[model samples]
Target: MDKNYYITTPIYYPSARPHMGHAYSSIVADFFARFKRIDGFNVHFLTGTDEHGLKIQRAAERKKIDPQTFCDEISQTFRDLSKTLNLSNTDFIRTTEERHKKTVQHLWNELEKNDDIYLSKYSGWYSVSDEAYYSDEEISEKENVKIAISSGSSVEWIEEESYFFRLSKWQDELLKYYEKNPDFISPKSRKNEVISFVKGGLKDLSISRKAFSWGIKVPNSQDHVIYVWLDALTNYLSALNYPDTNDELFKKFWPASVHLIGKDILRFHSVYWPAFLMAAKIPLPKKVYGHGWILSGDEKMSKSKGNILDPLDIIEIYGLDPLRYYLIKEVSFGNDGNISQDRLEDCINSDLANNYGNLCQRVTAFAEKNCSSLVPDNTKFNDEDLVMLNKFTDNLDLIRTEIDNQNINYYINFIVSALFEANKYFNDQEPWKKKDDKDRLNTIVYTSLEMIRKISFMLYPIIPSSIEKALKIFNLNIDAINLESIAKHDYLISGKPINKIDILFKKIEKKHD
Candidate 1:
């Protein structure tokens, strides 16, 4: 059997437009999925909208549309984002879909059969904004109204007939699991926070909400709707055609390799999600990485705050790959990153346009001018030439390790730095000055072209279209753009005329109004 690697972005709640947060998770998942595919794994990348929730129900009410209509409209936006952002997702599963509803119901039934689900009257401070029931300690008073302390969302005290999952009963088991698999949750800080929350003790989770009817119906119960998190979390399984674990996709990709989620939802994924799986006799996903938010200034983005940065707007201004590169390069995966327009311009102008793109233009332009727009054969090897060539070969393992660890900044920063070194090598050699010495110039151009080829392969996942265009200059195809192909040098055919290529990244002018 081929090694299978399955990864998922948490199904985004579509109470509003998809923003940078939604884009961040999906992009990271896409990046890893592409990396794993190139690393020779059978990869399944899943991302979609979480449409069934009180938040959506209320948003739909205000919009004067049925929940499904509201969901469909918003869901389409997220689907479009996947395309606009160049995400190579294998599947996009919405909670409102029949396939997903069936899987969620099946899982609920399994939990009920195990006696881990029971009826109860649920009364607590509930954040409709959060779609979560919070204990008194987790809520605080603000302007004579209760709110969740963590999210500062308004909460209401309500009583409802509900189905409760025996989440508290598995406290010890969850602790043991965390201890045994220290890496089950990532970024050490988020893992510690989860451990502390579980250690402080868990209360049984109300898995059904009777207050609203805009969610997945509880199995065999019409009065109650299955909690949105429960319905939404199962998307990872549903996308694989679960309940029929005998299906080829399910059999091949069960127990997802990782659940890439936002840090705010860490408890739901790390605590409630695992306990539910344990109760249902289903294997847990191998890992859950709760990454931090992309803040729009000092504050976390909220519609009420009028601070949500629409990703489409950014893409429109900067194009897709620049936006992708900025997010991955600027944001520390497990910590909140404040994005500013100025910062974005500086990053793109310095890294993509000046450093990487300028190097490509100069070297390829040199080849065009002197080497007859054809790839030249290396004539002589010098210490600098070998060192410059070795940069790509020597760093392959380290790059693989960084990608595996989800240390994206390190991986991206290394690539940019290597390109800078290549630029320095170009300056030191001065291929333009050596035009009279055809042999030396050919050797320099050939060596530089190989370096560009290697970096382009590494860059394909992050900025696919731009890198594809860059590699096309050397007549490389998508099929030949993998680690194994780039592992060896001298792959570029000598005397093959290169294709005409445009500038990869045009410098962005900063706007100050």
Candidate 2:
């Protein structure tokens, strides 16, 4: 109860427009934020765009506009995405913002003062597509030559250059920290990858790129600007009003609960960010989880792969909640998952429309037709109904627990199974056939109303918008239900007229050529 949880989705690079992959990550973080809120923790959820970098500069140049102008336009796209997804992010810190700029410089000065940063000349394989450095081994040769440094990203051998973070010095410290806190990185597979990379060796990472002017200046050094990672990562403390620990925001939420990033940047978050925190003598964030990438067909999605996504298209077709729910619910959060329109349609039809939606539709429809448009009281229940409802509500605590622990697939499967149990119980007790038995019909329909209320409350955290609508369809008010309310043997009152129900989720049909 005393735990303070602050979580952040890795600030997305704004060079590209918002897409399904982007939406998926932010939505997952939002889900965690919601879960923490329901668990009654003081939660601070941060999400934003990494607006300053060489990629943004390049993208701006391609668009024939100043980098800041392009960022302004592109940043709005991300802001729009938040509205589209209904993200409950507490703060959205754009790296280009004035508050973030000051925050980045403060962290830079702290690191420099601690001697963790120093001037160093750099020469290495840099990939513009990734805004990353390759240690020569990662690149390939088509015919006895390294791939010609493509993209406008500078590979010009600059012998006279900017400051470097002495990443090599903290190698042992980082390894020791990981050893002591094995749970620091999630999904064991990602943890193993980071450990192996660290064990192989640590290189003094170049923390400043003088070639790019669209970045934060290196404190008093006018010519050298802080590297994107240094600037970008500091937004964590920035949003919390860092450099002023007395500030309430900082005091309330300093050490983040988790830093969620894609596997592509494990080195940056798991390796570099902690090193930076250690240098500043600040508490490291509780966890850094490098989740798996979303794949297009069999390959990682990219612009060149011609699979660049626009989740907006999906949203316009299926509404926000369904689209949001499917991404997290269908794909296990820790691993690579393929996204196809056809698959989305199937999940919507089978899971949302058929299993979940139809259960509400038929049950409410039966109540209005046979027993009046009101929830009736169940004086007595069949043993079968009792067992099914009991089993369905049994693991309500475990569902919230699984979600908190990020066992996403396990949590979803529990709800789906519960829905199936409800469906079976409803089908077996055909109240319509017992038309002469008024008492039996009332009991059956009333039991269904209570069960529907139970399931609807359980779903509110996951799919709030849908559950709210489902409550209306059942002619029940959501204000009455709580977590404890789901498990009760009897919940509804007698002689309350129930209304006719409609489908909560309609199956989305895929277009065929």
**By TM-score, who's the top model here?**
1
List model 1 lDDT by residue over 1-513, tens digit each.
447999999888888888888888888889899888877889999999999888888899999999999989999999998998899998888888999999999999999999999998988888888888889898888899888999999998889888999988999999999999988999899999999999998889889988788888887898899998899888888898999979999999988888999899999899998998998888999999989998877888888678898888888888888888888888888899876788789978998898888888888888888888998987586888888878767888888777767889888887888888888888998888887888889988888888888888888888888887887788777667778666677788789987657888888877678
Best by lDDT: 1
**Candidate 1 lDDT (Cα, whole model)?**
0.87
Compose the digit string of candidate 2's lDDT tens values, residues 351-435. Answer: 8888888888888777777767776667777787788778656776886667656787886777788888778878888887989
TM-scores, all models, native as reference: 0.96, 0.91
For each candidate in the order shown, give its overall lDDT on alpha carbons: 0.87, 0.78
Superposed by TM-score, candidate 1 places the C-alpha of residue 216 at a distance from the truth, in angstroms, of 2.0
lDDT of 2 at 363: 83
> Which residue segments of model 2 deviate by more than 4 Å?
143-158, 379-382, 434-440, 474-484, 488-498, 509-513
TM-score for predicted model 1 compared with the true structure: 0.96
